[model samples]
Target: VLLGIKMSPEPLKKKHGRAAASGEKRSKRKPKRKETFSVYIYKVLKQVHPDLGISSKAMSIMNSFVSDMLERLAAEAARLAHYGGRATLSSREVQAAARLLLPGELARHAVSEGTKAVAKYTSSE
Candidate 1:
């Protein structure tokens, strides 16, 4: 008003949540999801197609696929261990499980990858 400019009242700001709902400790971050494979899935997808976007439906299917794969792998590994009379599971059982569950080249690749992971883990320890 001093400089001949009209000053207008600022529009009211709307805040989310209750004004008087006190005593609750809330975090600004999203809660960690039960299925924590989202990061891995996104990384794998990005490796194949950097510019590609995943739909929620496709992501759900991917999560289900990962869950099924893990279940089958674990079951097969446990079965192999049980049959071999071993009280503990080892890479051998996992390799055999992969061999039995996966087809041909995929099985071979899985064993190789598992071997690498085991080696890395052991060497780190």
Candidate 2:
């Protein structure tokens, strides 16, 4: 006795919309992520106030504040470098920019801390 049955010799291929239509395989790659300033904000908040908790709204506000400050500082630093005709912006330009951006005693404190940080980083290298 003989019964007829038919099947393709090739295994079935898994189909993706565009890839299948084009006869192309999907790439196996992880996506790159954009940088966020919130991580730095969280770290500093944790250090300054270990028991403190921040609301989402408050965190968002802080994120914007930090971002705006950085932008202003960078702009000022770049302007200083351009005015000085330097190809590279040095720590001195950054310190001057901080002073111009910040006011009075706060400016002095920030400059001092920045100087110490730069010195430590250079010494380590």
Please tell me which predicted candidate would have the highest lDDT against the true structure. Answer: 2
Question: In model 1, where do residues sit more than 4 Å from their true spots?
Answer: 1-33
Worst 10 residues of 2 by lDDT: 16-25
| Model 1 worst lDDT window (10 residues) | 18-27
Model 2 regions more than 4 Å off: 1-32
Q: What is the TM-score of each candidate against the true structure?
A: 0.71, 0.75
Predicted candidate 2 versus true structure: per-residue lDDT over 85-121, tens digit per residue: 9989888899999999999999999998998999899
1-125 per-residue lDDT for model 1 (tens digits): 65986565894344567462454344576878685577799999999999999998888888999999989999999999999998898888888889999999998898898899999999999
lDDT of 2 at 5: 41
| Strongest candidate by TM-score | 2
TM-score of model 1 (CA atoms): 0.71
lDDT for every model?
0.85, 0.86
Which residue pairs clash within candidate 1?
none
